[model samples]
Target: MTPHNELRLLPWSGPDGKPCFLLSTDGPLSRLAGLTEAAQLDIAADLLEHAHEVLADESSAPEELRLVPSDLTGALGDALRVAASRGHRLPTPGTSDHGDSNEVPHLPAGAFG
Candidate 1:
């Protein structure tokens, strides 16, 4: 019987003991890396980038790589909502609820000054 590789991602850690994110492969992890391993490294690096953002937020957490869906929009939406609720406003996409500032106080990253 042939065994299939299961994708695994490890959170890269900063000096602070929090994971920044990095990609690692072992035994069964190679399959998800794909038919060629070259593409796998690129995907791994991207995962690390995403992990940085995930760690910044107190609400959302980085999940195991295989469990994550290809559709990231919905997952990002939830993260944005959580940030919004905490007074963090996303960059202006266009005219949107500008007048409803009272609904949720939006403080951009550097609004303190």
Candidate 2:
């Protein structure tokens, strides 16, 4: 699949039961391993940095920025939570399946009854 399509599946639990997703289009991470925990953490940092770059400037994103995963923060995470609670994953770019153009549900009036 294309990098863009591959990225849609990021933050995915890898086959090894690890929480890393592929990025850089350099190939899968299954091939990379070492005897140190720091080595693995380094890989995770690269992935996170790339994720932020893509989200910040979609145009500057590498054409091959494949298999990237998103770790939502702040507003993005809040939106995702509402979506998950109501049974939906990230909305496709520009899609508004819900009645409003925002598609995201507002925090329930006052957030609790």
lDDT (Cα atoms) of all candidates against the true structure: 0.41, 0.44
On residues 1-113, what C-alpha lDDT tens digit does candidate 1 reach at each position? 11123222222225885423223333444343223234434455575577666666667745533344443544454344333322322323343444544444569979887
Tens digit of per-residue lDDT, candidate 2, span 1-113:
22333432233346886544443433444223111233434555666676777768757645435435433243344344333422323455555645568554568677787
Show where candidate 1 strays beyond 4 Å.
1-35, 61-113
Question: What TM-score does structure 2 among the candidates reach?
Answer: 0.26
Candidate 2 global Cα RMSD:
16.5
Each prediction's number of clashing residue pairs: 2, 0
Best by lDDT: 2
Best by TM-score: 2
TM-score of each: 0.24, 0.26
**Lowest lDDT 10-residue stretch of candidate 2:** 30-39
Scored against the true structure, residue 16 in model 2 reaches a CA lDDT of: 86
lDDT of 1: 0.41
